[model samples]
Target: MRHRLYVPTAAAACLLLAIPASAAQPTPGAPGIGDSYYPTYGNGGYDVSHYDLRLKYQPEDDGLEGTATITATAKQDLSRFNLDFALDVDSVLVGGKKAGFAKTGDHELEITPSSALASGRSFTVVVRYRGTPSAVEASGFTGWLRTPDGGVAANEPESAWWWFPSNDHPLDKATYDVSVAVPDGTQAISNGTLQSSSSKLGWTRYNWRSSKPQATYLATLAVGRFDITTDTTADGLPVINAYSKDLGANDGAARASVERSIEVADWLGEVFGPYPFDALGGYVPNVPTGYALETQTRPFYSPRQFANGSNVSVVVHELAHQWYGDSVSLKDWRDIWVNEGFARYAQWLWSEKEGEGTAQELADYVYSQHPADDPFWTVKPGDPGPENQFHGAVYDRGAVALQALRNEVGDKDFFAILKQWPTQHRYGNASVADFRKFAEQVSGKRLTELFDTWLFTPSKPSALSARQAAVGTVKAPERPRSWKKIRATDSVHAHRH
Candidate 1:
């Protein structure tokens, strides 16, 4: 049945037509999301809420083919938009209608919907793609790691581009459901919980779900033969630890450290706040990348992190990031201090608990070792350029700054700032300035002078302030040998951030 509306009169029709219409007009979305350091890292004009990926892999050829269904809401009316991806696309569909698509630049896929997408309209983008991720490189490196049996998708700042299309930045966090089909006899591990696994006709499909919002850099998955372990925290959150069967001599140390995932996460909760995610675990993949990454609930560890022996300090560093780096992420790459500083400080705290050294002792010792004229003082952790984003000063000096703050505000306020910072910004992004304001608000003290001396100034402070020197001054006796585990230069390469 059809209903008809009557225009009562020509005057009335004219009056209705005279009313204003919506102001929005379709325009091409920005090609980049405006990061000063890495401008082209993410796209603008839309926010992804979730991703549902269906993928299949051939380990023998390192080939991957997949269809990605991205759910997002347009922030502005748009005729076209971009996604950060590096793959061979076969077809694209916007809201079930065929859409035009083209590959642009090195890692961007520009898409044109059949019609303009109105502001605030929820839409679905389905992209069909296939490629050998190991062969694809952007920004002069490949995030995909090909192993003897299978491959691992794990890297910092940018990894999803090689394995899955995404709004590839910490600023655009979204939940994910990744389903990968691989040949039988191999296990696929990913972030969050394993939803389902089924095998049929010599192929196994493993579906993993990340119920919490996760940054694109922190989302990871690996498919290979593993010695998998399962446990639960006191809070009953599931813990899944996996180590490649071929770890050789490092196997014992890897398990010894990663096995403490449950213990370490719980300790971090008491020091920071309640664990932010629903799951807890770590994996030691047999890759030579030397650095371990805090990848959401399941942190990834390179075998070399344990080459010397058991390294629970590195474990503490990565798990602390579950709060500092993973739960409350960086608003921009320049806020590297907010992540590395807090994580390194946690290592110092762990040292105190293990009878190694107090945070103040560790801070003073580090300060005493670096001379006033040393170039180390020239690198400001708060604004170290892109080239020095992961420089050792960002980690060591960053933590030193925290100890200075603790002394300035006293223990009560400093601990409160630590626990509250993550609670206030849980599952979101924050800048170092935002953190300073929060600290000042919580401690009721002006921190600009302190932050300036430690974070902003490109040179070391004239000397540790009286508050910073309360722990017997920088000329204290030799620190215990165990201090090695408390510093970022501990040979573990925790500076991989």
Candidate 2:
């Protein structure tokens, strides 16, 4: 379910009467993930097809150095090619041969090709580099945290190059075969299913394979002391992984909640589509920060939030991304509702199934509770404010838009859209306009009005009569005071603008 909003000419003027003095700029072009600059590799350089990584971690120095063998398909004749990587890389090699490459800023590697890569041909580049991970406040890329037991914790985002060389953008989707070698007694977990593990030369090598094409930002790896737990979904999907050093102390509780994640996955598949990945799991490292991330194959969970039912929602949120965020990703950041909104809607759907309420009840609750003064489509998915992007508007308002769409399209057509969406656009990016076109095509109805009202417009239209508000009845919740509070809050918020 998705909705759009439109403002009438005269009414739009009235609404903007109190707008802030500063004019909003037109949305910028899609910037590469984790960095604000445009990418050079995809413009006129090498097109990376695959990557093979051999990484060595140094916990004492809080750093990692890696040797990356990248195979790229050339699109044009070129004597030099540039690669997008984070600031920490040191060197580059062309076809196993040393090549001169210079570091530009902290996010790009410029390589001078020894020989021109002819168009319609493939070439390999091997890069060797080392660096200590640095925290990126811009998008929360890489950072280290101090543990309670006097140890350090680290996670990489679009900024994996703070420790390793990576393409680091969503558009450059590629298949990765990675092998991480860590110190004795420590474990390294990464995207995709684990292939095998062997100890040699006093280092443990964990090999992982991600056959599915993945955006660079979703690529991740975590290294620490962790306890492993395995399980199976009722539908027979391999659910055999959860990493947490502390799970040993609370094995019963952790296992129970972890097992419930499988049930949630099953429900999402039944409602939406297939699981969209080969495997799914989480790693709860013994870190103090209560932050969770939806990496490609597995999401990194924070143990602090897993205490009660709180972690369950996080699990559903990340799992939903396997379809919305991972499978059919957003082409640009400004269209973030494609990711966060769908994932958030899935969370609400899971809650409704777990006896939270029926779909209508949940939709009514969102309509009644969410602040209507804010424009849903005004939120540019890419450069949204920190709190507004992933959590508030992208998640809550975006889900509400979907619910609104469901109301307009009906169940049969709506679910059909959901199931076909990932399958139709696998490994590709989509925008709001693309979804709107698809919906109209499937339902055989002009939904221009519904989309305008629900998405582009800043406020909900006047309540419709029982017969006019689509199908189903919404039994208004019992709290009259709550309704009044919400209306008053919205009025005030709108007045302030």
Candidate 3:
């Protein structure tokens, strides 16, 4: 889990003075309004306004039964309503009445409303399902147990079978309140703050409130016997309530980074604005996978990597996502840079603060690694297959794009724009073009070519020297540059195409 970190001493002072006193206002009457630049079938043709989920786990059968009450707001009056859901659901109900729904695939569901839902109106639909879930290979959507000797294993992609009906795409977001009834002693965790929990009728009911909008894939539920530790940040926000069954083994190292996590949060708030969630925490599950997930308020970490410091970067990366991916979501998969790029950039910013390297040094290192022919926004402007959207092309290359912009606009203005972005578009969505216009407006520079070259085109811009010059003094170190060789790996299964 060892990784590189960079820190910049002088850049912080320079960045504070770079921005102008006055902020630029967005232009009025722009076409394709909202965060996304491209046209979208709003709510993906189905409006999931709210969800009430009740799930009961049966460890004896190694399965669960979920009953969901979905309330949708219709934009158009139609005779038929379609809902997407993972395979394994048994039945559905519309307005408290049974309705026919057929499973089209492992990742899709088709349902006809018991009655037509008029435009500008809302209706409720419920689904009852049961299945033995299978976890996707290496994906965090896994359910498993640990051996007595402390080895980890799982059944992943379980959302396909164990969970309630869902669109299962990042673009389709909705509000959910989940209540899971697990065996008496086991704990259950999900997105957002916990509302209430109690034992009733031989089971424990864990109710969670996710007031913020969230994509279905980011939704999670963990049920196991875990030791819980809770603390709050200096700012009074819940610091970390990390959980693990093997407390003595990994807790010490994981706890050691808690303050660092808060420090990073405080630093980011100074640069990017306030932390987005009401609470921020991480979970170290006893799992074999080496990857992590940014699941809204709570992120999941692999216990196997908990002892290694390299996993702390995963914390930085995922926390950055709270502002980038969670707050201002991407409308389509192709615009995933809106998620990964900003998160990756935040990691670099953290490095700069940690005295790992100057921001310029890190930027230079990233630029040196990118292929000359690859652009940050090369993914097609549509639903570019999932595989094409989440790789280093989006993460590393996208961070490089922001670094280039920082170089061009200077750090002060660059951070102002970055801080302003989430505040203005919080809980909404955004695309690359929308971001470009916003950046241009904030910096008072018409950067169409810069945008086109780094994002839309197929190559890195040749004006790197000029761009660096615009940002003020940045001395490129002559030391051997191996940090640039640390390319992001395409090994995470959840990110697979």
Model 1 regions lying over 4 Å from their true place: 1-23, 467-477, 487-497
TM-score of 3: 0.79
Which candidate number maximizes lDDT? 1
Task: Give lDDT tens digits, candidate 3, residues 404-471.
Answer: 78878987899999999999888787877789889998999998877666666655556455845577
Looking at model 1, which ten-residue stretch has the lowest summed lDDT? Answer: 488-497
Worst ten-residue run, lDDT, model 3? 26-35
lDDT of 3 at 444: 98
In model 3, the runs with Cα more than 4 Å from the true position are 1-44, 59-61, 135-162, 247-251, 304-307, 370-385, 467-497
* Candidate 1, residue 261: lDDT: 83
Q: Looking at candidate 2, what is the lDDT of residue 140? A: 32
Residue 18 accuracy (lDDT) in model 3: 86
CA-lDDT, candidates in order:
0.88, 0.63, 0.63
User: Candidate 1's residue-wise lDDT over 380-423, tens digit each?
Assistant: 99999888788789998999899999989999999999999999
* Candidate 2 positional error at 313, Å: 2.2
Model 2 CA deviation exceeding 4 Å by range: 1-44, 134-157, 233-237, 247-254, 371-388, 459-497
Candidate with the larger lDDT of 1 and 3:
1
